[model samples]
Target: MATPTIKALSAVIFALSSNAMATELRIDNVKLYQPAEQMFSAPTSIYIEHGNIVKLLPSTHKQKVADHVIDAKGQFAVAGLMDLHVHLGSSGSNYTNFQYLPVEAHFNANLYLGVTDIVDLFSFDNVLTEAKQLQQTQTSPNLFYAGTLFTNPGGHGTQFGGKAYVINQDSDIEALWQQHLATNPHVTKAVIESFGGMGNTLTDTQLAELGKRSKAANLPYFVHVSTLADGKRAIKAGASALAHGINGEDIDAEFIELMLSHNVTYIPTLAVYHNHASESEHQQISHQTELLPVLHKKLQGCLFDKVPEPNVWFKTMWQKRAHAYQNIVKLHKAGVTIATGSDAGNPYTLHGIGLHNEIDALAMAGLANGEIINAATINGATTLAVDDKQGQLAQGYKANFILLNENPLQNINALHHINAVYKEGVKINREQLAERNQIIQPVGQECNANITSQTAQAVIDNFNDKNQWLTVSDSAMGGGSATELVLKDKVLTVKTSLGKPTHFGAWAGTEIRFKQPNDASNFDGVALTYKGSKAPFTLSIYHSEVQDWDHFSKMLPASEDWTTVKVPFSEFKQFGFGNKVQWSAKSITGLNFVWRSMPGTPPPVPNNEFHLKSIGYF
Candidate 1:
């Protein structure tokens, strides 16, 4: 565990002690983890009066002065959580209005989940400002938010009503950003939706210019980009954080390095996606869980009517919302910043209760209770710029805490054991929260059977290797010939025994050519494995139909040893290049690996050695 910085400590202390003039109440006998940098454990006492921490003293000092005293009695009291990507003021409409989300209820919702501060990056965001003011006038949750997502003309979130989701390319986006700041949403939310969901639509120059302006304006510019070209483009654009993991893109080392270099923080809304899709169609929903009953009831009352009666939007929403937490384990181990957020307000997924599901998903994602808690707590605060106050338990932080009958850190499901919730100095008993918790508990059998990290890894690994394949293309005639892969002195390698593209045209006449077919069978794909000479080599695939150069072609990563990789089915194209696709075989048999997108077209006897190897289908 990395130590929290001194700056983080100072921020928490500042937030706690800021309201020094408030009344005083002492809370003692709790184990505190002020994760701002240090670990303090003792019979610590917090002196909070009127919604703010007045001082942190030893329990012995509690007798000196205080209006009310709460005996923590060894309860694990940590700072409140911060949810950066929350959907506030929600309904069935593309936008949610604050009218439906009352201040009292909204504040109570945060208190229920131990989330003291929040950032509602949605339409009708003025409510956040009001909430902040309410915190001063009336007791409410500390809230900060972004007005709305700025996007391109007909870009990503066009149907999302409320504020303008579609920013016509012709309109001045910077001007719109300026207008947003004027409204005081705190942060400026921007969109870099991939063009046609194939490539990042934003240009580097545009990003640099926008980045400069956002920095100058002293606003953190958060981007909502997904997979393939869009993700590649936006990360290269220098972003503060990526709203989602490479949603439509495959996870690879190169992309990971890019994110690391840019220091891009990731808020993987895995629940939003996985809540719908799973290993099999039957596994998509928790068909056996007790949550189904609660979820069904919640769905009944939710803007279920808001979804079109005949539309398959709900179905489609789940289908597209497929994700595996394998990436979380990978990133966590890789030292990537992974935070928490529930992309709620969609369907079935609601606010308040939605976060618990997110926590559940984290457990399924293989994150330990400690990591998951920190991700949702401290890490979340960092994402929302509220770490100074929330996300820890210390002397000066706000007195937003929860007491559960069971330790959620031990079993994430224990999150349901909510015993008590405190907002500032007032205690809202668990009963108040349960009536609206909407969280379904597992009954007789745990539909939500706890699958530990070991099991999850095995499942994920098996899923990756399912339906594997090795696609071989037609070799252009010329001198290009094909042969079986061989191991030269124990080192497995491939040699281009026969063919070479003299010019960049088709295999001389096409008769001797082999190919990769773009057909339904080829979709939902498989992986290709081949050993390369060494690193620093380029493996490229191309087709004439690939009009967009950036997205036109794809490349295979260079690996030292023979490696198997899974390629998503959507990558194949209707390009007029490869001539031989032998589907009749029903399987890749005796297929000759042809062609290598050569690096400098010079020698290696021009288009050097190419080898053929086994391909796994998944």
Candidate 2:
């Protein structure tokens, strides 16, 4: 058993002698969790100074004079919990306002739930940079970020539009390594998606090279996997950890052994599936109103509508969830390290409170109360490679902890009953923390809405006019591809080629800029005359009301000759690429034609072509 390392024995004498410094903060009459003993000690008085635990005295010890003191009144005290997998800015629409997300709101939510530290698996560089500064204020939880993700062209990470380092060939490795070194991220992330074909995956050589670079840099290499095969491939490629548990399959002994031998920690975010499997369960756990004035409006909205209406995929995931739960139990019994991760901010997984749901799910999966506590606390720190600095209650550990109204040792759900939270030895006011999020007026006056750009309805051109067409490609954002419009012999040709390689995907295409924003309600759909090889290309119509990229995409039916395609607006499913919520026939922006790699298709390779004649809507 490991013992707590005493950090300041001199503080004990200062505390008992009535000479405690004005900077000291003390908590009295608290039953504290002793990690080495794996049990709670009798009521003790703890003295803290300079954000570190300084001394522990018996319950009978006289209260020393201190600048600040909290009477625990026999309440249970435990080391602050750590969320191993979290995304303050995530892969969904919530990120549409990521830049505007009130930092106070984000931090308060975690503090209120007793999660004093978070390992942000993925975030834009700017967001991570800003967060690094915010965590130093002694109010917010400590943040550790992977900074950016290196993914296959058009792989899962690219769809979110976060900072993605694209790796298309083995030669791209050196540049990626340099980029990782420049950022100095806490971990290096790579994606191995299961829904797509092998093209979307990194070759074994690539994964191994990433591992090599990460090891050379002394950074942990964490891989995101979805299926059993993806997990196996990632591990074989030298991944240090599995970002998520494999779904849709049982954990065989061989696989368990593989994980054990590699010393990989499994962060099974079961709460992600719980939201898909049962809405009522989400409703039961989504106690956002309890958070009161500080809860962000967006999070409040999520509380009300936790998940999309259950679809066929939901039903399928529900069945697979059972298999996943059993596999987790097997891994735990085999002495494999399992940590609690909610994948918060995904859909129904709310930050802070959602982690409690994860703990409950782990409990149901056969983890004892002590094991669940360890997973959330020490094990979580271990997973993020920060165990030495955070996660345990001991001398030398940062004085970040939570006082609970009930004993979590008796019932894991007692974690939800937070009495108070402390960061750096200072108690946080939940109400004041929420109040700081309120906004006042801006420095400038009103009338900002009058600014407008060159937005108008487009006039259809039949390839007879050269100025009517403009070409756009992924090259603008580090993608390799060029599409050009050529007019010869009274024919308009769209010539495209895979340029170098892209972080997103490689493709070139053209769009007809609308003269002014048009109302989609005035028209039913679009009709276009296009001719190309049997290969497919994407046709998207853009609208302005979206928060992010607001557009609807459809694959052009396979064709080898000229074909007239008419698609109704109803057939188009809106995505984050264009607009957010205002998805009505109210405002339409423009249209795009591109041959590129989408989410579930083959990886974007080097050759594709298309030609267009006219575009119009009836």
Candidate 3:
């Protein structure tokens, strides 16, 4: 509920002074969150030698004066927080907006929030390698990562427009795993989705094969799922963990038994669901604009859009989150290991900062403050299979913890009230971090300005011949709606009717691909012609085969007359959050036409219909 203020970013005329470090360090008379008892320990003196916690002694005991000693009372200490699910290298300002933020910004975001360790579920392998190295040389959290997200070709992973390992068949599993291992990742990530609830997932044989190969390699594998069916299927296929909890349903007895018996860890990632709720509660952003200019432009655009009334889909998502939260409590009661994963670096989920929200959400799901702390700390380390080295305060364990101004055992929100962070016996300068966050600018890459050309042979589909286009709809998941691509009289007709209420909406659509993925680098825009009845509908175009869930969209104006809609490459923003600029026209994918209501508007009328004659680049 704390709103970040402009003064948080205002320039200050103070220099950062260093915290003196020594070979031996003592933290005396501080309340400790004891993992063994799952409660705060009495005032204790923690002795550290050579970056390791060496002793937990009675504060009253007289001992050799240490090389450096902190205060003698009235502070709380807990194992530094760990976020199990995060995308450390992602800008996350938008769904498809891409930016390469400085490593320091990421470190500052987590450290400022008292998160001293993080496990990134997906990112480019090289980027993860760099982040791992940065952790040792800089004052950053202990970093762990799953090198890349492996999934079916053109599947969930492809929507992000990033480099990913595509699993076309069983053979791809070993190949992708070997390539990933070359980067020395701590875990592997895979995704299973029904194409936004409109398509199909990989065959059972394929999933089993992937799971089999992953287990054979003796590595921890995390599978991403959104529905109960997929979650159960993934577990049966031998997934080591579920990256996110299922929505829209409760965790039934079967789910509880399967996970408990299989020993599969569950990362609820409630932060993402809470983000959807926050989006529905648009008023939350009105007072935060003063902090906007300090962030990237794409982030600014996303914030601007959230200031409007809640959209129908966002409202559905907000309500659906309750179901997921309930499932988390059920799973925890069934003895399923619950790890706190923020799914950060997604919309509205800031890295490092978002983890606190996840912890808060877990508390709301009926977890005690001690249990929540354990989930955020050791539970995450256990999920990442690195509990031996990190996650707790004990002799031989890494001397990593956060000094808190208040006891988090009494109030979970106290986790955000960070006083100082000690990683491996070295202290971080909080004032210096504040200054860095205030002055840091976004490192977004600009597109090439000189690249421009017109498409001479631009026709993609004339609707005169048969082609492979698959329609997907929310009905696949439980929504009520049917859709079809009917080509008659040399025109393609897209028709739909309202179905049951669903968070994603009751609609149908398909992705149209070129003969081969066209790298339309020479072209600069797309031109399409269409006409529709008096129904509210939208047309989306995927300009390239980038894995980004982005497209150029325009409302198909309702008219008895044919209308020509041209979406210039420059006009396309990534989920309405990009700086409409330079882009590669090559690799143009397909078009998706759907009947859905826009946010802050009434639901669409029944029996929506539209027609398309031609689509091509201009």
Candidate 4:
């Protein structure tokens, strides 16, 4: 370690500060864990300027007074983990597309989760271009977002997420290439989910055009090929990578032969797979790891008034997804590139925990510890075309690494025992980072009891009154622990539990139960107090039962600070199932909520997490 110009601050001290100063990060007394090399260096001090890492100095020098200093005694530090297939622009599988954060919020969430980099796999051109700007400015984790996926005209990502879209028949190779590159996206995707995960192969001309054009533009292409058919096409089309490893079906040795032949990277979002796996071993291992405390706590909070069987799909997936990765292991040994992917913000997986779960699943895949680290660090960086400065521990490489408590080379689980995470040169305290990285919780997990004063007022209004009633997104999906809810004055907060991009996208909204014997009339309106994204975002109220499947009311616009909006009751409708008989909803029991693209779609009715202050008759 080289000598530092000044001293560094420690985690214990940073945790005690009344407010974060937001610059100058220094870390000392840390054993750096280099996963790529499978080695741990002795004690060293790291110096950070702004948020980027500036230098790695020796701990022998007396530390200086930096803005933030994290003490990493008896701990290890490594690069912040990266999730390749994470989703934040939308909420749940319904694709209300609301979880995308204000740039600052997203950055802070990723930082806490120890996610130094992220690839929002399915964002739109406008949304992604903006995020790329933030990344360049270093406002958030190094970001790489594909503007939107390209499925067959009516394929999967097109209708599912309400993301930006342009139809290109596989026949129009030139038009296809032009449209994809127009977004200035990080990567383009082919929605394989449309073909039941087997994948709808774009024609040879289309594939050849993609290879040529992307290569010409210096922008690589990625595909969501979750099956053998898709895997084969990605190879034939020369796709740079595949999101989510081959799942649900067996991979023939011939397919493995093909992947290695094309050098196409495979990102198995193992965490999403684990959440949906049905096998006991996978479940037990997932539960036994350090991620268990956070994962279980989140799932437990899914109950809105103890509703039964919510988030059951998560457990069921975990059980059924057991054998899904057998082929991935063969690939690992076959010298195929199987990178880490969390597919965070899906129905069962959130952010920070998603990375942890991915690491765990990778371990189950029989990967060498060094290989897993490479997958998250170098491999992901390679796919993003930022390898020049993102991965590795070379002097000129951006100062990004994680300090582990144990040698990951010895046991892959050591990745979870994070002591510190350094981005650029600034070293973040592991504990502080973990607290912020936690994004979403499971369906029945506990939740923060905190609520903003305005939101509290709403909760109280409903609580004290006998007739106050409402419906909401999945409770556990809404907020992790009741305790996480915080309201100072009227501004509400949704913070990450990890130090990077691990945790993000949990919102809460309420729907009123039309229990009035006379049948409750429509709500007069809804009130919201929120801190919008760095740019702007949309908040919407849906009066329908179909989550992300029905027409939605107008979206209330947003701003940077805590602001309020009152949606008109005219915007409300009788969602076919509540107490409004004759004109009443005959079966739809709950009115759902969702968040739309800040400058994008108006979102279909979907039960996404929304932080609310109040909803009622004006």
Candidate 5:
């Protein structure tokens, strides 16, 4: 076994000193799940020491002395659940205000819902680093991540702030691969989606080269494919798993044969699709789970009143739900390995509860409870290449399991009736987790008071309120740009370094997100008091109606001295492929103040600074 990190050792020390855990513990009289038999074993006793399961014997075996003993009273014990696909940084909502939950909250939520391990398919580098560091001392679910995804420029993976490495025919594949490897990612993921020709896609050659690099590094290669052709191509190129179900067509015998031959695991992520297709306002499990009140309200509000005319992307996803569901059923019947993934950070899927919703979707697709259990357990571990140490309740494996009030094999819903959750032989305090949830609301102010007052000028952010802001740059897209935001004495300062521009150019800045839409339609424009560099800056406005990164933006003239700038709503122009529509500031979600260096421009001095005394709708 690998040596534990110092943080892990410290956690053990704290648990022992606080009497939260015993040095040697035994759980008795439990119906333990036996993965080999796909059934519950007779009454059994599990002995755990040093955070690993040491023995699993019949309950009638000679009683062994231990530091502590738990009488389970025949409760069913199964391997803690795993979510193979997740984005840890996102709060599971597309709305800007609802997307800023602290990363720890996501970890706690997963543990609260009995998910012991999660694979973040795509995440920002900072988030991945923080999560891995926190795992050592914190009681978070074990995290495995693909730091940045691979995709073409302006591809599906490039959206939502360009959290991917975009490549082209002339790009240095080896250099890009090396940079990605530097992150020490456990798995490598690439996107092969075209969104029905509405977006760019990575070429077959690009896909094959990525596969070769991943194989050479001994990393599992997972691909996001949407159509039958894309799925077959991914498997042919040495894909270890399909990140999503094929949604463009029916699964045929040929595709099944290809998947079987390649041994490529399939993660349908059916819950994301089901959530988009259904008109329901909320998932019953979400309400039962511990969610911050603000988050719960936003989630419900976003899903409650269906839009009369959904955008093309939204309509497309909704129409593909049936195809995705049918494909999962067909693939399962063909003996393809189906793993559970909630794609939780998407529109309506919440983290901890999202996995349960995925299991429920699988049941609706005709999978037996036993099959769903395997999918959520061993199958997920196999997909992540960690089967030897996780995904089972067997002796010698890590003592991570969930004790439930009833037998999950008898009824799928029994999985939700969790009596206790254990990680590395330490029992988690669910009540304390609940209390944390109550206080851990989303970090931003809502414009509820002035939302309906037509004459009231909405304050987007004053830099003095209890609102959270983020500093973002093009480094996420492989550019060298960097940015930082500091607030002090009621003033916000933005420092930026516009690195040499890539094919996509360079941008660095700061943004403030709202918890709910701010009705700025009553105002004519945005005005901000600022001072600093004479370099040009841009003010970008994000709204609910525009879902993509092409938020409407207006250029601001250079201000070498302290000055106030006012940008009219009519001056904002769409920066990308989004439809050209009249500016409607009724549901403004966020705003960004950015410095851009267009392609071919001489790299500017690395030092650039600006200050914002205040910003609001005027």
Candidate 6:
């Protein structure tokens, strides 16, 4: 016979490994938390087979046959936690250095914190699909997503860049529903808030129509509402769940009765509000090993700094935090089904750790430790419509649980004392997970070696090297915009569709990022040759001190004929909520030229074009 080949030998080894992993695993001498009963049971031996709990034997039982056995020594075992509101595409905060980390890092962070499952309320379709596929090849949390957020044109959901299904008075509801169905979403989400006059919202008729379609397809309809009025309207319009805690006002008995009558679940994402009000919890976990190194450094630097003077936004956030806490207590006392959703990927809410902060917030809101655990587990599973097989530590359920050093029922913070974590009967290799989730280098870093020293007259771009330019559109934030860049004859042309503007309006632009930070202090300002559409354009400057979207920008005159515009550095002003700081121009990162429309601007027309011949500092 011929000698066995290397490929065949490798295949045989893989098969043997698979068989070994599939063998029965017995966890002995562990106290299990029974979610259904809201209590812990006596020490027991859990027999797991094929990734499901097959039996729960008494610790002293005579029969103990299994392929693998772990002596737990009386550790507490509970169903792995679940975070229902997350945006896996984001790194929790845009201000952090790790904002650009790949989505896999978020998954690994969740698993490290013992979150066995997550539900992404809104994200781009491709991102959700890619995350779903990663589940098969890696040790990741079970991911469920609501592919597209159904909102009105220029609504709250549309403010983020992906394509939100925008409903207008003339829209074909049935056609839109068919398109939404094509995305194969696990849940249907809609925005019903006016967002404090920031944008328009879906009408009751449109919401009811969408809810009817969702029910027809056997999917739960969840609505994002901040006010008690919107909460009532959502339930009346057939919402299966309210996606956030009511913060615009205190929830009263009437609203509670209405919710009870409609059997709507309440997902109070209190951690997000609490994070805005105080960064104490975030500061405590800034040094965690599970966090990527860059993010860890950024957090440590900012979280412990002396508190700044309270601004209007800060005061508003504190009020909302108080309202959210009070409202959750009222809702829980009224017997409402309160689920935990951390709203991770917001400003300060870290993904995996956000859930723990949410639980702590729930406890601070007067929920008992057992009630908080129930909210973190079974209630979240119920909201996802997966409680039948998940969110419980019992026979006939998936063997997904966390082994804790102490019982959480007695002290909720004990949940943080994780001894080991298991998902689908297999122990997680946390060190491997961290290694696989290393932070991704920022875009354009590879060209750093090619960067030359800059002087006052140094050229940034001459439109001849197309490789240095990148096209950007509103889609990056979830708007309906599109952009394309073409370079020819030493001139760069930008083709753009402004798309539908959100509350922030629509933007399409071209950007050139520096491979390394540039010190442009010697230069007075930038001079660029450009000719574009009649719509106004902006020249935005990015630097190390500004992390959010509120970069310093100066408006450029719209010109039908090519003109050289010189903008002095003194003219640039901070836009949006960025902190006011002195201009240094010492660590410039990039520059952007964009066409933007304000809220009242007419709906955009197609096929807009612009051209840039040269760009440099004078």
Best by lDDT: 5
RMSD of each: 20.2, 8.4, 14.5, 16.6, 11.0, 8.3
Off by over 4 Å in 3: 1-23, 95-100, 216-218, 279-312, 443-618
Residue 157 in model 1: shift from native, Å?
2.8
Candidate 5: residue 220 lDDT (0-100): 90
Clashing pairs in 6: 160-477, 160-478, 161-477, 161-478, 161-479, 162-478
Per-model TM-score on C-alpha atoms: 0.57, 0.74, 0.68, 0.59, 0.71, 0.77
Highest TM-score model number: 6
lDDT tens digits, residue span 1-618, model 4: 965443344555665573454337677787665645577677877666644555666688766556778777746666667778776654332122122333443455456556788888886555565666666765357677776666554345644435434335655656655666776677766655534422233455665566666767777677776668767877777788887776666789788888888888888787775643322233433444454333323333331212222233344445545456687777878888767778876644655657766877777767777788888777887777787777665445677776666777788777766545567665555454334435533222133332222111122232223434343322232122111333444433332121101012222343343321211243345455554433223333332233322323454554555566766645644333222322222222233334322112222322222344444333
On residues 140-177, what C-alpha lDDT tens digit does candidate 2 reach at each position? 88876787887877566765645687788999989877
**How many clashes (backbone N, Cα, C below 3 Å) per candidate?**
43, 17, 16, 125, 0, 6
Candidate 5: list runs displaced more than 4 Å. Answer: 1-23, 276-312, 447-450, 455-618
User: Which portions of model 4 show Cα errors greater than 4 Å?
Assistant: 1-29, 42-74, 91-106, 129-139, 161-173, 197-201, 276-300, 303-322, 428-618
Per-residue alpha-carbon lDDT of candidate 1 for residues 1-618, written as tens digits (9 for 90 to 100): 999899999998876675443346777776555454334356677777666666776665534455567788766655565556666655212111111334445555566656666666665655555666667765455666666666654344443434553444534666776677677766666677543333224456666666666667767667776664555566776666677665433567876777778876787776666443331244423332422322323333232322222123234434443344666677788877777776655433445555666777778768877787788777876665666766766545667776644555556665544555667767755445445434432122222222222111111112122222233322422123343433444233444332432233211110111133222233344456555543223322332122222112234455666677666535533232322222221221121223443312433322234332543345
lDDT of 1: 0.51
Answer with 2 or 3, whichever has the higher TM-score. 2
Kindly indicate the candidate among 4 and 5 with the higher TM-score: 5
Q: How do these models rank on TM-score, best leading? A: 6, 2, 5, 3, 4, 1
Off by over 4 Å in 6: 1-26, 57-69, 93-106, 138-140, 156-163, 169-171, 182-184, 273-282, 288-319, 345-350, 438-453, 458-501, 506-543, 553-571, 585-597, 601-618
lDDT preference between candidates 1 and 2, better one: 2
lDDT per residue (tens digit) for residues 525-574 in model 3: 77778887567566676664333344666655676778887777776655
